[model samples]
Target: MKLKKLSAQCLLALGSLLALGAAQAQERVTAAIPGVVNAGTPIEFIQDGFKGTEGPIAAPDGAVLFTENNNARIIRIAPDNTTSVFLDNTNGANALAYSPEGELVAVQTIEPRVGVILPQGNARTLAVKVDDSLGFGRPNDLVVDKKGFVYFTDSGANGAVKPDPTKTAAPAVYRISPEYVIERIAKDITRPNGITLSPDEKTLYVANTAGEHIYAFDIDAKGKVGPRREFAHLEGLRQTENGPSSGADGLVVDAEGRLYVASNTGIQVFSAKGEPLGTIALPKQPQNLAFGGPGKKYLYVVGRGAVYRIPTLTAGYAGRAK
Candidate 1:
């Protein structure tokens, strides 16, 4: 995860900034008109004994895949409600996404590796800590576009004994193009964590966890990100008994262009214009979310050693059936 760099003024907005601090609500606002208050309901709890689960992505075939970072595995919850291990020995896999051809791309936080997991559970290094030319501190989260290009973050927190306190990589974001070209997209994020593409796949959102903000980028046809811009900032995120001791984790987009963020305060919904519209309360802090189920109207949340869901009024941006 990237660390937040803040001036005293920014801290006043977030309230308190900690890697795992609990959040206090400034105030509660009502959901906008035509929004469903009970659009979501709790679903099954897939308890696989994970110390923590960070990212959950919906597979094209309808299964929801997630990372068990503590256990070093990727688990899957089938549409039929069965649970299975998708891949083991993933070595600190934090976030995952599907490429255009359905290949699973994961950001490995351990040694800051990028891996492609085969459909059969075999994992191989797509990009490793090759040399000084690449940009990856400790890959934490990732998202893939309609093309095979992979955009991931590096946070560098696995069990490796190699210690580089002065690592200049400095919690940056990067993109691995279809041709395997690596490019440093941004460097100023204060602990960048979760990431997602827009419903139209024209924009990219990267959540800066410790900084209590999300950065938006314009995605060109070449899959390269333009200069970074601030999208939303949740100034003071804190932890609760439910999950995420503090900070933001993952993000998912809805069909209507609303962005849903999983953070210490549950799931916050924001309009395309960056207005805070409403929220889905969760028993635990949500690390990640995905829209699934029959009509793609269900939002699946992975948090606090469990997997839960609530229904939504709109369809999921990534799971529409043809």
Candidate 2:
């Protein structure tokens, strides 16, 4: 009788421990920004073992697409959570955006160019040289405006790779007009990694991975930006041997004009005017994110060779897929 009683006690303790573990896991998926995300919403791990994941964007059909840069391909995760290769031989593409004409525009880093990579056979280059002489300095991310203007960022030389004065251009943001004219828009950024526009397309936001602030630019009707301003101060910035790194990578705007940033802390939420709403912590540091799934109510995040998704109370901006 004593043996049976001790066994029952052990079983009860195990069940209690399991319940505690599950509750702790749910607590981690916090919905600090009330309407954006609800409390106790679980962040579901979809897949893992990616070579390198970045630049997640939503598809027109309610699927989420992201790049595995190290594998040189783009993967699509359907609403049902199944995965497939959307595009291959991406030339080391990192970030992706859909053009007004529904073409897949990407920032290719192998040859370091920005262009259309889809409708596959008809892929063409949009911009290659930063000037009449020098080439781009590692094109990082891009976003296509409504007028078909491709705005992208060149991250410049990183780590041991020193910039060659005669060849590589400095870090800057460039806009390729519909007429194929390459114009440098901003050059003062320390390290611009992710790029996005507001719901109205009147404001541009760029993430500085090496800095604590996400910069914003005022855009005119002619696509000319007034000046770069410190928009929102990011959380979870830490000093490293290389320098201060916030790990701010991807920017996406919601339908309500709220801005979401993928940073070292997790997904940082900000108001349309750059106010801190709160943060949604993840199992891994998110590198990029997008809203997809049915009704575009799912937030898909990719980083650290894994992909995760959580149901959001809000939908993504339907104006553009980012």
Candidate 3:
């Protein structure tokens, strides 16, 4: 029945796109430097010599923000190609999203918690524990919609024992409404990790790190997740001198609705129909990416100790916001 429901949902989504027109449904982009993965396209290494980084979120003013997990700091890559610390003394700020009202919402990597930080640098705890009952193992990635609702993933077996195997609740995706109420969306996903929303705010794409797959969820008017569907499957590609297989990690969506996935090989682009489009080679294995700049044509990519940007065909969330 799950398979059938997903088939129906895909058809419905495709039909909705058709109703809108094909020109708006698909977008194509390539690296600015043809094939060389250089920093010419404002590919600035904001800070170097860090353990790792991920979850690049684009703010309103064409600034891109990402988490330096090893250093427990959130850094901003300015539009001028400079870098500065947005938040410090943060505990493993892994994935972050900007609310409709411009608040920075983050999934704490070290602690099993979600926090909301204001532009003035004030941080407030939102949801500390899952369901207000079970202790969280790790709260991984998050994304927010235009309606001020936040959707996040919790992989409950980070270091601790799997939480309740019989229930398949160890790895799950959740949604938090504007009123601050929380609800579990999907609990059976294998290692739900990186997450983002479609440009139309109708679909949710989640990456399962261990499972090596990206899953999709249809979000309804009430913010309810319909069912689980496979968005993309990652096979272990040829390993580079840098690290592991092209295991998929973080995800971001463009104004044209294409999904940009951070993988070991580089950045993988996929259409809304789950078709493999192309790959953007990186100097190093990128951990995450975001679109920024004046027209949202710049792609900001993050690696271990560096960040880079290239020109893309589609504008980013920042440009789209306007």
C-alpha TM-scores of all predictions: 0.78, 0.89, 0.77
Is 1 or 2 the stronger prediction by TM-score? Answer: 2
Q: lDDT by residue for model 2 over 1-322, one digit each (tens)?
A: 9999999999999999998886565345676577798787888878878998988988888788999998889999988898999988998898999999999999987777898998888789998887766887678888998889898998886622344657888889888988999888888888998899998999999999989999999998866788899999999989988678899988888889899999999999999989999999998889988888887788899999989898888898887886
What CA RMSD would candidate 3 show?
Answer: 17.2
List the pairs of residues colliding in candidate 2.
Answer: none
Q: Which residue ranges in model 3 land beyond 4 Å of their true spot? A: 1-47, 119-122, 157-169, 235-246, 318-322
lDDT of each: 0.70, 0.87, 0.72
Candidate 3's residue-wise lDDT over 162-191, tens digit each? 444443336678888888888888888766
Ranking of all candidate structures by their TM-score, best first: 2, 1, 3
True-structure RMSD for candidate 2: 4.7
TM-score of 1: 0.78
1-322, model 1: which lDDT tens digit per residue?
Answer: 1235456557766665642243222122223324533433333444534677777877777777888887889888888768888888877788887777766777876556787866646556777743464435668788877667687876544335343645536677778878777777787876778887787777888887766567899987765568888787663366545333337778888878888888767788888877777666665667888777766777777887877766566778743211
